[model samples]
Target: MKKFQITFKGQVYELDVEEIGSATPAPAATKTVAASTPAPTPVKSAAPKAAAPKAAPTPAGAQTVLAPMPGKIFKVNVQTGDSIKRGDVICVLEAMKMENEIMATQDGKVSEVRVKVGQLVSTGDVLVVTA
Candidate 1:
């Protein structure tokens, strides 16, 4: 059994909880002996976790630009066949009452404008495709 102390609304409470694997009930004699003895404190251990690999910033020859966050496309600045350079604003997205500029990560000729103005897009949704 585990003992816990909780404070709520200025009131304090003491609670006892049993572990899941310990399903059997204690005998009357054992219960009495346990009530007379104090319980031991628990210790916690921390372990480091490995970081996950990230996707490539720019896709191959024909690349698609994805939305970085969930939002509605406020405006699309480019069309098919448009020439663009790195870091050029491709669209304006509105999310959480803020406007965000979606920029091109690499220089390419836009082959597809995947999303339209006023369209709702989610994180990682394709916004534009470049060739």
Candidate 2:
């Protein structure tokens, strides 16, 4: 057995290690235990909470625009009753640090905006509706 002192991320640790001669390779899993003082409890605050924006309901038979991937809504370009054409960019979505434009598929008036700015959406989640 050998004693060694190691410092990681400004924390010091003392470890005792024993070497065993073996023909078979050792098992793959390993664990580490750290001995330290417990972290302090977080302070509670009395600040008021802001209300999260809600997603609007999708209209029946309206052309539904869905998100292509999981991301946050970066910007919304269309509003209810806004005229849009096919291939027109209606919103911007940020996913994996990339900005993606959500476009209109058919010429129509925007019937509903199903998502809001800064909202997180998953793949195939409804984003907009046109009629």
Instruction: Please provide, for model 1 over 1-131, each residue's C-alpha lDDT reduced to its tens digit, 9 standing for 90 to 100.
Output: 66787665555667987666556864333344477687865543334445655543555668898999999999999999999999999999999999999999999999888789899989998899998
Candidate 2 lDDT tens digits, 1-131: 55677665555567977657966655655645566856657444434445766656666777899999999999999999999999999999999999999899999999888889999999998898889
Task: Estimate the lDDT of model 1.
Answer: 0.83
Q: Which residue pairs in candidate 2 have backbone atoms (N, alpha carbon, C) closer than 3 angstroms, thus clashing?
A: none
| CA error at residue 16 for candidate 1, angstroms | 36
lDDT for 36 in candidate 2 is 82
Model 2 clash number: 0
| Global Cα RMSD, each model | 12.4, 11.2
> Against the correct fold, how does model 1 do in TM-score?
0.54
Model 2 stretches astray by more than 4 angstroms: 1-57
Q: Each model's TM-score?
A: 0.54, 0.56
Q: Which candidate is the best by lDDT?
A: 2
